[model samples]
Target: MTSDTPEARSALRDSASRTLRLEQQAIAALVERLDAGFDRACELILACQGRVVVTGMGKSGHVAGKIAATLASTGTPAFFVHPGEASHGDLGMITPGDVVLALSNSGETAEVTALLPLLKRMKVPLISMTGRPASTLARHAEAHLDAGVEREACPLDLAPTASTTAALALGDALAVALLESRGFTAEDFALSHPGGSLGKRLLLRVGDLMHSGERLPRVALGSPLRDALLEITRQGLGFTCVVAPDGTLAGVYTDGDLRRTLDQHSDLSGLSVDAVMTRPGKRVSPETLAAEAVRLMEDHRISALAVVDEAGRPVGALHMHDLLASGVI
Candidate 1:
């Protein structure tokens, strides 16, 4: 119900600015509060023989779900369960081997608090996150992560604003700490995300995208220049591998070489490919990652490469076009 007047716009900006500032302050306050209690939570989860089951009510539920996902993706095995659902036989989903992470800003959410007795009987460990450390839920847990904020960013101090932001940031810090302690690598991260570009960069090998057998362009050492040119044209890789009499890679002649050679000599009646090829051309092995192959091609200013084996024999051919087609570019 505000107008388009400058005064109204300025008031709207002020509200947004205040909200951001309050949330920023909430996150900053968590820095010193991170102590041995945070370490205990990590140790409990890490030592557990099973998954970490996270549960919460209301806005805390949304934040709990995200925390579970981040933990699962990083290295910890975790999943989210609704507290309300837990009372309806879903409680059977949890077992003695699992650790529980319960979130409740007020620390006394009825749906969440009701699980305490059953969890205690099952002998499962509980880690509570709450704004009030002395609250019933926090007092019953093994580790209490204090996500308290001075006040809500909501002007009315009722809506979950700075509290949720603080909780989310604390969850992220926990996941990252576990990831570092586990020595997780990008390769490990890629394993968890195998369908995207990140996975392709780490998993796709040169052999997976190479052109081999009949599709590979190659010529013999004593072959005529016309034969090499024909193979290059037939394969459309813009280059041909010249093999020695022993079936080993001797050299390679590219389209660039062809253009340059033609500029210097027109009479090719007695010329062999060996005399005009680039010896020991830039090469790669089938085990190389397609991402690494892309770097090699770009580094050498060439569009194609000869895939060689340990015996110096050409096994296949790789082109920039092949990389592009495979979405590795």
Candidate 2:
């Protein structure tokens, strides 16, 4: 059998390292090119009354779709329209209130450039991201971002490797900048992504899911154990608050307490709720975030908690099931 030589290994390593270096150089070039033009592009998108229409061809099209999604999830409304599709009836989606962001390494993708005249006729602002600022698309754009790369990662420098990566990063930078400029909040992001976990974390508040008013499981301190059990069953929270006669949270009774009480006393009906209730129970305030409440419940190995007011009066109750049902946990 022939043995592998150090020369072959060294050559392969050098090629791989060179490709990375070229890509790094491409990204560095993009950073240097970021200036007033980038700012103008961001401002144009922010001022857009309609959505940001992103279009590209081939690999650039994939990046454009991702960029559009990032913009939509963050605060700016954007959507990707394939350049080929735009030549058809899809061009109707573009309006004067919208900003058109066209992506092409050569700045002259035939499919994308074909729509330029129509976009101009509609008076829609054009923002170009391309490797060649002197290309036709860049020359006609209101703002041109130089997404040029030093070279492709491919050995023959034929593929759109480094250039595409640089363009995608530049697109992300623009979207994030526009998001910040518009004062986009987490809640705003959640509103756009209502089905995602981030939306649950940001939009699910304590009050939104907490059990309130008469639905809250509560028993007066002097109430019998049977009454406490009835309260827990009626509320279906696995526990009940033990309130003092003056309407203050005195303690809590749970299934655990019932088991312990039943073990010590044969007749639970004769026992007072205070006699079986666990005193100084862990509680949460109405203002606490529902996610935080979930953490507290999990950490304590408990299923429910009373939401107490500043005066220590029980106003509401929350169960782990409530959080699970609301998609907060």
Candidate 3:
């Protein structure tokens, strides 16, 4: 198959298209197969006092692992254990209160089938996902999920392509249904993924990233420009918040204002901080998302903002560098 040949290119495109269509049809078939067994499977998992123990062999094992991860991240506690490993010693991980989800395309995989008797002896609830409903594994399961597909996408019909895709889709359906029934919120998802970008966006708040207490640069309303400059330098925020006698934010005096004052050739001897400050500058609440803070900074073309309370008092300060250091940028 030469890269320059039209015949080879056509063959590749046709093969990809056929594979995608076959997988699509396989997943579509699962929609009608959603019978009472699905509800029972969900009920078993939901009512499980312990975690959902997922087990399978070969390609089914890979799908089982992903399903277990999805379940754990979505609010249900679950983990994957290989059927082969279970026979060795990992069977001890399966407690009596846990629900077992077994995956086998033919439902006759030796490793998976070997565990049926032990699971029954332990009195653990079994939910089997197989292509053959009448197979031994399915017949023994408390609830059987039929994930059969019409045909494999492989030309030889030996590789597990369409069947695996259907099983993965069915597993996703179960995870989503369980998630909805448990009312799993995005905050809960964030708690499970606190190291990723999604976690930063959902879990990091303004208060977590803002500089408070002595780190907040501030100058009183009647203070001199020189005093505000000292506060800005001491705090190293490139700006200083102006506060009223009652400690409420009055305005903001940034380096930009200093440049403008210099352009006007204004004398620095008698200028109060309020005389050259930008009043009512953009501010954010402590509970605001750090991602939203980035948007506000980008939209207004500013580098710093005062974190204020409900009474308009400057409680904290945030700079662009703060966000960058916190990985919110």
Best by lDDT: 3
- lDDT agreement of model 1 with the native: 0.94
What C-alpha lDDT, on a 0 to 100 scale, does residue 116 get in candidate 3? 92
User: Going through the candidates in order, what is the number of backbone clashes in each?
Assistant: 0, 0, 0
lDDT of candidate 2 over 1-329, digit per residue (tens): 22378888788789889888888888877877898889889889988999999999999999999999999888888999999988989999888899999999998899999998998899999999998989999999999888988778887888889988899889989988988898999889889887878888877777788889889999888898889999999988999999998888999999888889878998765788877789978799888878889899889998889889999999999888989998887
Which candidate leads in TM-score? 1
Indicate whether candidate 1 or candidate 2 has the larger TM-score.
1
Lowest lDDT block of 10, candidate 2: 1-10
Error of 3 at 140 (Å): 0.7
TM-score of each: 0.92, 0.82, 0.91
Off by over 4 Å in 1: 1-8, 268-270
Supply candidate 1's per-residue lDDT for 18.
97
lDDT of 1 at 303: 97
Better of 2 and 3 by TM-score: 3
lDDT by candidate, in order shown: 0.94, 0.88, 0.95
- Spell out the clash pairs found in candidate 1: none
Model 3, runs deviating above 4 Å: 263-265, 295-301, 309-313
Model 2: which residue pairs collide? none
